[model samples]
Target: MFLEVGGNRSTRRKPTVTRENMQTHQRDREMLIWSNPGVEPTTSLLGSQSSNHLATMQSVMYELMSELNDRSEDLERQMLSLEQRVEQLTAGFNALPAHLSATLSAQHAALVHLLRERDSRDYHRAAGGGGASDAGAVVAVVPLSPASPLTHIPSLQLLRYKLPLLRKRPPQCQL
Candidate 1:
């Protein structure tokens, strides 16, 4: 039998329909499973594109993770700083009343000492000079002994101690 060459009606030399030739024709028409430079890029192109997509996704995930870790660390630092500030404020609040009490107690003691010194001076001047002229004058005695009960007693106890013993007359007001 003869075969048409190039779809021209001209018949070429008689050709043999061999089994190997038929298999080669079928192979050309079917899909190729392997890579070939002559064929369009199908499987290789898809595989490479998928690999690129996976790499991009991994980079994005890494960036997100890094950002999250940084934010968490920043929050932890802020929490620690806030806790320290709270502690300082609490300590200051707790100490304020005690500090005020001590300061007031010291002032009261100093005032009581001054009053005693003034009375002692007035009494001596009155007995020596005369009463009316000595009434306005004031004096001070420094460095009372540590062993003195007058120096060591609490203000409440000192106020209760008999001031009449040191003065000629009684005070107008009493605790």
Candidate 2:
């Protein structure tokens, strides 16, 4: 290549690279590679050290993968438990109306039985209690259940008569 002097091209020779200049350039390149962490040096520098760093990176990656798998399994177990609880709640909710209907049916049966007993007794009283309706009628009307609506009548006679007849108690069930 020609040399440019004062914006004019001149016929001249290019400088030759000496051995010392080549060595200095090599040293500068190596120094640059060492100073910058982004540059990976050649394995010719330290083969054992590079191998050690690779091994350490692999071990750390394995540990992280193992921990991730363990956490994922724990989360799956928790989700399964929550799903089972939800199923139990749904089952209980679905059965609520049936249970309520059964309980109400039992209470209705008891009420009907009480009404029939009261009607029978009133019929008997109207029929003159078989010719002995005064004290005998009072005694007969005293043995009904304490929970009977007949026992809560707003009357002058049957108000104090919760001990006339012992009827069968209604069936009870737990919720």
Candidate 3:
């Protein structure tokens, strides 16, 4: 028999298979088998091992997917909880201004009532069981100081202007 040599296409004579070369080849094949005992050099055995590895890899991928899904669900629940809390806070914030206005108005009315009661008491004391002329002639005026709480109120801006006039008048009774 003849074998083609490279791209040259030259026909080379077949090598003579000596007994010694055949023995060497057999020894090399035996050594390869001996290196890994009980491991058959068969396509079927290799295919089965490859299939087992593929199954194990698929199972691992499924487990990872399940864990990812569970984590995503937990995060979604937490996000919904946070959104609910934010809505509650927003509602409270929206109602705050009206509640504050009501509180300020109540305080203003209480202050006005107190002032009127004080003025009434002062007028009665000046009258001293006398006629209406004594009550009209004697005027009891209270001086508003800069440090008073009324100065801090935005709605009581007119009171700051009226304070000077009250200060100019002399008090009938000093309390």
- Write one digit per residue (lDDT tens) for candidate 1, span 1-175: 4565664555556577988888987786554634365655566678789899999999999999999999999999999999999999999987776665565455544655556556667668768654522222321223333234343444444454544344443343333
Model 1's alpha-carbon lDDT is 0.60
For residues 50-158, could you state the per-residue lDDT of candidate 3 as single tens digits? 9999999999999999999999999999999999999999999877766665655555455444545555666688877553332223323333333344335543554
Best-to-worst TM-score order: 3, 1, 2
TM-score per prediction, in order, is 0.47, 0.47, 0.52
Best by TM-score: 3
RMSD of 2: 13.2
Structure candidate 3, residue pairs in collision: none
**Candidate 3: segments with Cα more than 4 A from true spot:** 1-46, 128-155, 159-175
Tens-digit lDDT track for model 2 on 63-118?
99999999999999999999999999999987776665555445544544554555
Q: What is residue 108's positional error in candidate 1, in angstroms?
A: 1.4
Cα lDDT, all candidates: 0.60, 0.57, 0.60
